[model samples]
Target: MARADALEKLRETLINRRRALVRSATGELNQLQGRSAKTGDLLDAVAESLQSELNSQLLEAESRELTAIDDALERLDQGEFGKCEACDRAIPLTRLRAVPYAKECIECHRASVKRRSHPAATINRVFDSYQRAQ
Candidate 1:
């Protein structure tokens, strides 16, 4: 694809996501700041615990997205922006339109998803060990 086309797509994505990002971050900050004024330590612990979990997940997703965008931009600099990372094939324009941060072609992405969905580990330790032992 042309350089102008890639830039236009990138700008559109930035414009669409920027306001939402700002709103999310600002809302979280306001809640965290207002928390102390509105409640005691016990209530604050509950609220902050929930907010911290939520914010952590959101931040992680945002970090992944930013990394992808940076990778795409770097690829553009090297004139390989639309190539699939897994297969070294040219990613389809339609897929690129739908997902500008896609690093793999459709086939490879689907295969990867399939593999991820059936993860081998059943012992994901999200629960405390003592609780589990009980």
Candidate 2:
């Protein structure tokens, strides 16, 4: 449950998962390509639709997980890996084991979830502000 051990486990897991994901994606891509060439119009359409949805889901999950891993690595480099983002306290080792990519401790994370349940309008406002500054 040491910080370094937690980081090491997360790093290893991310690497293995990424390798598996790449293999899975390649297999799916090859299957789709074959189906595109061999199937008739109706069958091809269905295959294409299913393939598209599968690809979307796979890519989304991969991207999200990779981002989390990368963020964790960045924190590792910063020597802030086991620290909570919200309260600026040390994140519990047990919690880190449960959620290797955790940015905040449990209480802060719950607060964040509550806040995000209500959508914010800051996206457009931030973009507008940036454009006006430009």
Cα lDDT tens digits, model 2, 1-134, are 65677667766754664566467667766665666456568876887788777876655555555566577778887888878899998888777655566778888877977788522123223323533765
Cα displacement (angstroms), candidate 1, residue 22, comes to: 6.7
- Model 2, position 118, has a per-residue lDDT of 27
Note the residue pairs that clash in candidate 1: none
Could you give candidate 1's per-residue lDDT for residues 5-96 as a string of tens digits?
Answer: 86457646644544454566567666656655554678768977788777766555554555555666677778777789899988887767
Best by TM-score: 2
lDDT of 1 at 122: 15
> What is the overall TM-score of model 1 with all chains considered together?
0.63
- Which regions of candidate 2 are displaced past 4 Å? 1-9, 22-35, 41-44, 117-134
The TM-scores, one per candidate, come to 0.63, 0.66
In model 2, which range of ten residues has the least summed lDDT? 118-127
